[model samples]
Target: MRTIRIPYAELPANARAAVEAHTGPALKADSASEGLNSEIAVRLVSRTGEYYVKGRRASHRWAWTQRREAEVNPFIRGIAPALIARVESAGWDLLIFEAVDGHHADYRPGSPDLPKVVDVIRRLGQLPCPTIELRHAEQRLERYVDRPEDVAYFAGDTLLHTDWNNTNVLVAGDRALVVDWGWATKGAPWLDAAFWVIWLIASGHEPASAEQWAAQVPAWQGATVEGIDAFAVANAHMWDEIGGHDPDSWTARMVDAARRWRDHRKA
Candidate 1:
C-alpha cells in the first residue's frame, strides 16, 4: 500500500504554535493513522520529562467530540486513557492524552481476550452518563441508512461505542482499554455489543463459542436470535459507510453467521 502523507504545513498558525509550544525545539514527531480523523503523534524531549502528543485536525464539529470526552474521562478513569489537554484553534482541534502502553489486541476468532473484551464493553454501557444520549440502530440507520426499514428491528437504548474493532482497543497489563471515542454516542448498547460479536466470530471463533460469549453480556443476555439478526443487518449497513477493506466479504460473513444463528435457534 502507498503511504498517505498529510499536509501538516496547511495547519492553521495557532495549531502549529500549540504544537511547537508543547514540544520544544529538537522534538521528534510522527503522524499516525486514526481512521476517521486527521491525526498525528509527536514525541517530545525536555529536561522535565518526555511525553507523547496527539494532534487532530478538526472539522467544525471536532471540538465537541473531544470536549464531551473530557467530561466523561474523569468518570470512566482507568477504563480509558487519561485526557491531558485539548486545544481548539482556527478550525483545528488538538488533544493531548496520556499514551496508553501496550500493543493492539490480536482479535482473531477465539482469542483469549474475547470474553474480557465483551465484559469491558458491557461495563462501558453501564457507566453513568447524564448528558450524552446513547444512539441505537434506529438513529444510526437514519444517519447512514440508504433504505427504509433497513435497520428497523435492531434499535435499542444503550450507550454504544459505535465503532468497536480490534484496532480501537489497547491491551495493557491484562486489561483492555477502549480508545478513539470520536464515534461514541448514546444509543442501544447492544448495537456496539453486536458489532463486536460479529468481529469476534469473523476473526475465527466458532459460532457456538461466539454466541456464548455474547450471551454473557447483560446487554445481550436474553437477546433473541432475531434481535441479533437485526443487529447484524444494521451493523453491516453502518460498516458499509465506513468503507474498510473487503467490507463486502465481511458483511457477507456477518449476514451468514446471523442467518445460521437464527436457523439454529429455530431448530
Candidate 2:
C-alpha cells in the first residue's frame, strides 16, 4: 500500500527550515502523485533552483530507505538523478535530488522509450557492485523460493535496481534514467534484466517478446535455463503473497504476468 501523502506545509517547522537552508525559500511545492515510498514527495521551485524532495518521518519504520538511497547515489552517477542534499531534522529525514527534467518511461508495446530504457540497463550492468550495505538478492528472495538452495542462482557481485516499475524510469530525449534506489540490491548481473522482463510483460508484451528484450542486456545472455526457471517461480510466489489475491491490485496483475512467464519458460 502507498504511504499517505503529507502536505509540505505540514512538515515540522524545524524540518521545513532545514530544507529551505539548502533549497532557499520554496516558491512552490508541487506535491507529486506518483510512487509508493515517500510520505512527502514534492517538486520544489525556489529562488536558488528546482529540486525534488522525498521524505519520511525519522521515527517511521522505513526511514532507513532515505539513507539507503543517499548512500547509493554516488556509485550510480550517470544513470540516476544526483542527490544534492539529505536532511535529518526535527523528526524527518529528507532527500533532495537535482530535479530531473523528464517524464516517466512508457512501457507499452511499440513505445519508443523501450530502447532507451534498455540502454540504461546496459550501462548499469557495466558497473561493479559498490561496497555499501545492500541486501543480497538470494537472501531477499529466499523465503519465496520452493527450496532454499535455489537462492544460490541469484547470488553475485553486480549492483541491481530491482524495481522496474514504469514510474521508476524517467525518459528524456535519448536517455532513460532510473530512480528510487531505496530497494537497490547486490545480485547476479542477469537479475535486473529478469526484473525488467516482468514489467515488460505487465506492460502488454508477450512473454517471448519480453524475454527478447531482456536478451538485449549483455548479462541476460548468460542466464541459465534452470536459473531463469527458479526466478520465475520465486517471483510468481512472491507476488502471490504480496498481492493477497486481490485481483484488481497491481501486484495481482503482476502475479498473472509472472505466472504466464513462468509457464512459458517451463513449456
Candidate 3:
C-alpha cells in the first residue's frame, strides 16, 4: 500500500532543520511521483548542491528500509546513487543521496537499455555479499514456495537486487544504475537474473524471449533447471498474494507473468 505523501514544506521544523544542516538552505524541494515507498521523497536544491532525499516516520512499520539502504550504500557504490547522509530527527528517518541525472530504464523488446541493464546484472553477480544485515532469499520466499523444502534452492551468498521493475533502474550515458536497495537480499547468484525474467515478461516479452534475455547474464548459466522451476512457482504464489487477485493491478500482471514462466519451465 502506498503511504500518504507528506510534502517537504510540511515537515516539522526540527526535521527540516536537520536536513538543511547538510543541504544548506533548501531552495527547492521537488517531490517525486514515481516511488511507492517513502512518504517523503524529494529532490532538494540548495546553494550548496542537489540531493535526492527519502524518508518515513521513524515508527512506521517499514522504517527499517531506511536503515537498510544506508547500511548497504558503501558496498554498492558505483552501481547505485551514493548516500550522502542519514538523518533521524523529530520522529522521522531520512536518507540523503547524491542526485542522479538519468531516466528510468525502458524494458520493451529491442530497447537499448536492456543490454545496459543486463551488464549491470553481470557486475552485480561478481559482487560479494557484505557482512551487514540482509534477508536470506529462502526465508523471504518460504511462505510462497510450492513445497516447504524448496526454499533451499534459493540459498547462497550472492548480493541480489531482487526488485527488477523499470522504475528501480536508471539509465545514464552508457550505463544503467539500480536504485531502491530496500529489498536487497543474499541469494543464489543466478536468482537476480531469474527475478529479471518476470519483469521482462510483464513488459511484453514472451516467456522464451524473457529467458533468452536472462541468459545474457553469466550467472544465469549456473542456475539449475529445478531451482528455476521452483522459483517460478514460488514467485507466482507470492504475486498472487501480493496482488490480492486483482486483475487490473501491476501485481496481478506480475502474477500472470510468473505463471507463464513457471509453465514454460515445466515445458
Candidate 4:
C-alpha cells in the first residue's frame, strides 16, 4: 500500500517529541522517497549528526515489514546501514539509522557501480547466515516454481536480500551498501546472485550481458545450470503474475525481461 506521505510537521507532537528525546533537536527533516518499505522515509539533521528515519502507524498492516527490517539489521551489519534508534509509542513504530553519504546505484551495463555491487554481493555470500529464523528462497518461490524438486536448489544457509530494486542499493565511496532488509531471506549462496541477474536485465541489459555480469561472482559461476534455470522460471512466473494484475508498462517490461531471460536459459 502506498502510504500518504507524512511530512515531519504532520506527525503527532508526541512522535516528534520522541525523535527529539533521542537525537537532541531535529534541525531538519527532508523526505527521501526512494523505497516502498516505509511511509515516513526522511533524512533528519540534528545537533548530534545526520540520520535517516522511517516509520509507520502500528495499526498499518505493513508495519510488520519495518519491524522485520529492524529484526534483521544487526545480523547483516556490514552489508547494510546501521540502525541507530528505535521508538515504540502510542500506536506507532519508528526506526532511526545513521545516514550514509551515497546515491542510488546505476545498474546499467559498464557503469562503475556494477563492480562494486557485485563485490558487496560476494562478501555477503561469505558471511554465514545469522542464527535467526528467516524465510527460505524455496518457500518464497513455492507458489511460482514450475518444478517442486527445483526447490532443493535454493536450500542452503546463506543470507539473501531478495529484493534488488535500484533504490535499495547505495553506492558510497568504494562500497555498494545494500539497504532495506524487510525481504531478507536465508537461502543458497547462488540465489542472491540470481536475483541480481534479473535486476541487471531490468537495467537495460540483454540476458546474455546480464549473465556475463553475474558470472563475476564465484558462487554464481559455480551455480548449477539447472539451479539458475529453476530460479529464472520461478521469477518469470512471479513477474508474469504480478503484471497480469496491474498491467502497468513498467511491470509489463519487467515481465518480458524475466521471460526473455528464462527462455534464453531454456534454449
Of the two candidates 1 and 3, the one with more favorable lDDT, higher being better, is 3
User: Which of 2 and 4 is ahead in lDDT?
Assistant: 2
Q: Which ten residues in a row have the lowest lDDT in candidate 2?
A: 242-251
Off by over 4 Å in 1: 1-13, 19-26, 33-36, 41-52, 60-64, 133-137, 142-157, 240-267
lDDT of 4 by residue, 1-267 (tens): 346767877888888788778887899999987675577888999999999888999898877777778888888787899998788776778898889999999999889999998999898889877777678888998888888998888888888897888889999999988888877898889888888888888889999999988899878977898889989999999999888777877678888889999999999
Per-residue accuracy of model 3 over 31-150 as CA lDDT, tens digit each:
998876888999999999899999999999999989999999999988999999999999999999999999999998999999999999999888878999999999999999879889
| Residue pairs clashing, model 3 | none
TM-score of each model, paired residue for residue: 0.74, 0.98, 0.97, 0.95
RMSD of each: 4.5, 1.0, 1.1, 1.5
Q: Summing lDDT over every window of 10 consecutive residues in candidate 4, give the lowest-scoring window.
A: 1-10
Flag clash pairs in model 4.
Answer: none
Per-candidate local distance difference test: 0.61, 0.92, 0.92, 0.86
Candidates 1 and 2 compared: the better one by TM-score is 2
Location of the lowest summed lDDT over 10 successive residues in candidate 3:
242-251
lDDT of 3: 0.92
lDDT of 1: 0.61
